[model samples]
Target: MFAALPAGASGSFGLHPQDGPHVDVRIAITDDQVTLSLTMNLVFLDELIPQRREQADLIDPPESSQTIAALLEYFASEQPLLVDGEIVEPRIEALYIDDPSPELMPLFPRTGMRGLRKIRFELIYPLSSPPDRVQFTWNSYPMSELTGGPLVIKAELTAEGILDIVEFTEQERGYTWHRTGQDIQSRMLQVPEPVVQQEDSSLLSTISIIVMAVGAIVLIAMLVSGRPAEALATLILMVILVPLFYLVGRPGNTPPTKEEARTIFDSLHANVYRSFDYVDESDIYDALSLSVDDELLEQMYATIFRGLIMQEEGGAVSRVTRLTPLNFDLENVGMLSRPTGPGLPEREALGFNVLYTWQVEGTVTHWGHSHSRTNNYTARYGVIATEQGWRISQMQPLEQDRVDDDPEFTLDEDIEL
Candidate 1:
């Protein structure tokens, strides 16, 4: 169902199957620790609940010590919290069982059928100050399959609006958040495999090394066989090969040019929309840093993540398509000197503008229903040279016009599951 809302506990389940239980996780981060709140479906827990008979047994905990430990272990391993690259172990703090309200039951499928139980858990993990990068994996059922089907997970961060809400299905299972500002800077994560393979190739050096070894063996063989003429010719070839190999092996540094700046802006612009299209908030922030400065990164985060929170609440998801940059300009600002490193002199600063007209398709959905509209977006971007190359310093949205009226979708109260 196309429901609109931050994959919050309620709206998240509306998108998944009602016959099964889903897991909802909320994470809140403080300076020193991360708090995780997990809500599990009671219907789903039916299998895990131990059979009982006595009145005292009913008063006893519904879950056994082993069951609790196993669940905790599953949770800990499924979505490991990594500060930098180190995994942090979390301590379980609290657990409780409750029932969803009648009004809220409509937001979740099958909750009222056999009655629903909400199992809540609180866990805390220590963290470093200003972590380098925070990473998590989302796999609801990593160990064993349950009766209904695969588990659906909805995740959110209540760290004072620091993180965007996240949803995970069986298909998408990982999320990464990069640190920015407050002396916290992050380079792009390792280049994607395809991109890395395409750029800064190392094939030439490999070939050169192989040839050098072969040439040495050939020269030695010729000399041992009393073929001085061939050995001498081989020696000449080796000397010539030395300079050729050195030149080929030298790393090439392409200075930032206006054309390159434009390309960077276009890529960054496309990436921003692509992240939203895929419902990847972490990627949005990471890609933002590639072209935009920290201030603009934060602004974009607020606009893209915070603004969409309420919409997500209704179980609505947005997917962008066909983002076209119609026009752009890369203007050069005067060169300004900045220190490169210790004892190094300042170098010229490259500055520019990346202005363009963008056309895009926006698809939003709620409760299995969808609405799509075409939008024409015009904006100007300010790009400046940094140690990392050209990055966007500012972003100004000039205008946004809906190219078409949204398609209508009627939601029947008795919509089929």
Candidate 2:
């Protein structure tokens, strides 16, 4: 596709001859650029002969024969007349320059009249560039008295040297081979083998640089990923970030019957996760925002969080993980969890798994901690509706800190295990 064609352009090479001469010029406009042709007829003329007449013998008896002969001899010694000029020439007519634009004629010193004896001309066009139309007119005068024949002329012009444009590179050459202005996959340029060979070592250096860059990116990703909440908080701290997120987040949930379960899920992903493990305070709220009750949901959220964190006796090293889900399909809601990080011995024969699903009956906790006590977490949560939205509420935990005090209670409904 060509870029865009300009409106109402003259592409035909043409000539509109005037009485004195004929001027024909051809030009075209493509993609707002100009192209010109080789042949340009700028001037013209005509030649003719008249019938001879004999002088009467008694016209007063022309000048003496010797006198006339002497006069002709005298004229012969002088310059020979071609009759092209005013000697045998008729009155000079008018002059014209074809198309005129850019005010060039007024400003250019060479743009002016060319007068020779009987004719006068107006140079309407000066030194104009492409996009300017060229035009000219011939003089209509026919004077037979002075010269026996009319004038005839031939002229030519060149355009190649006038345009001096560059040759497009291979990649850019698509501008020619393909339709311009259309959406298409950009073609890749082929590099010469000689150039490739010259850059072989440099290519290795570039690859090394790229590898290092990717490594740094991954390291940064890991560092930031480990603290999803902190990253979110920092982003929210920006002047416009929170508003931008809110705009993106709020649009889908326009209530007059807002269904936002998917939105709830998106929010969680946007605000939670330090990776596969660990929950930060912002993640806690991200989950809390899904709560349906103002009071009960707030209570549940506060319970899972505490300024006074559980401290290991003797500052012992133990892992702590707390999580709250924001979006879940109750039908697909089931839990399968296992120890995944440090302190779970790599070669330890015993591993831990747990099933906390509501879908199927007979599902049971897989294993318990070595201690006799275990925790049943059902009392800690319920679903409710509030002015803000649906939320998890009324979580009742048996204890806050120790694995030892939690009860090994089972569901009383007893459909199965």
- On lDDT, the leading prediction is 1
Q: For residues 225-292, write the lDDT of model 1, one tens digit per residue.
A: 99999999998998898778777566533435566665666666655554443234665566666655
lDDT (tens digit, per residue) of candidate 2 on 1-417: 001112212122221112222222222233323222222112221111111214211111232233233323332333111111211111112222223223322322331111100111211111223322222122222322223333221112112211111222223321111122311111111111110112254655565566556555655675667966655554444435434544544322222111233333222222211111123444334444443233443454454333122222222111222222212332222121221246664321111111121111111110001002212222223333233433333344442222333244332232210
Ten contiguous residues with the weakest lDDT in model 1: 189-198
What lDDT score is found at residue 126 in candidate 2?
Answer: 17
* Per-model lDDT: 0.55, 0.26
Best by TM-score: 1
Model 1 lDDT, full chain set = 0.55
